[model samples]
Target: MSKVENSSAESGQVKVPESVVMTVKNFRSASDIDNFYRYINDNRLRREAKMILDTVVKAITPPKRRRRSKRVVH
Candidate 1:
């Protein structure tokens, strides 16, 4: 894995493993998806993270789930 050495702290470039890049390219498991979310959540780069979360993460996560109500009366 080629280590991405952060050239500058102010650059807002975080080092990511090659495996992580591969996983993001094609998710293999829930953990892979989780890694994407975690990266967005954990990063101090709010603007970048927000953009990805709003576009990609927002699309993939389930919107909602509803259950039918059941009632019995005498």
Candidate 2:
């Protein structure tokens, strides 16, 4: 766990624990032009929480039961 520092103007206060800045930096540096798409695709959930809802919909959906086929007499 790393700590980042940022300062506020109006309040004149200093804050820390802005690790997301580091995460983005790491993400950019590690990813190449072609692989960047994969990186974004992989991190889409982290970028936007709404993706979890979409995944939940798929997870909660009930699977359709298949009807048994009757065997014909030979």
What does candidate 2 score in Cα RMSD to the true structure? 16.9
Question: Root-mean-square deviation of each candidate, in angstroms?
Answer: 17.1, 16.9
lDDT of 2 by residue, 1-74 (tens): 23333325445675656653456547656546338656657877445545766788889999889999999999
Please give the clash total of every predicted structure, in order: 0, 0
Top-TM-score structure, candidate number: 1
Model 1 stretches astray by more than 4 angstroms: 1-45
TM-score of each: 0.30, 0.28
Looking at model 1, residue 60 earns an lDDT score of 94
Worst 10 residues of 2 by lDDT: 1-10
**Model 1 C-alpha RMSD to native:** 17.1
Which candidate has the top score in lDDT? 1
TM-score, model 1 to reference = 0.30
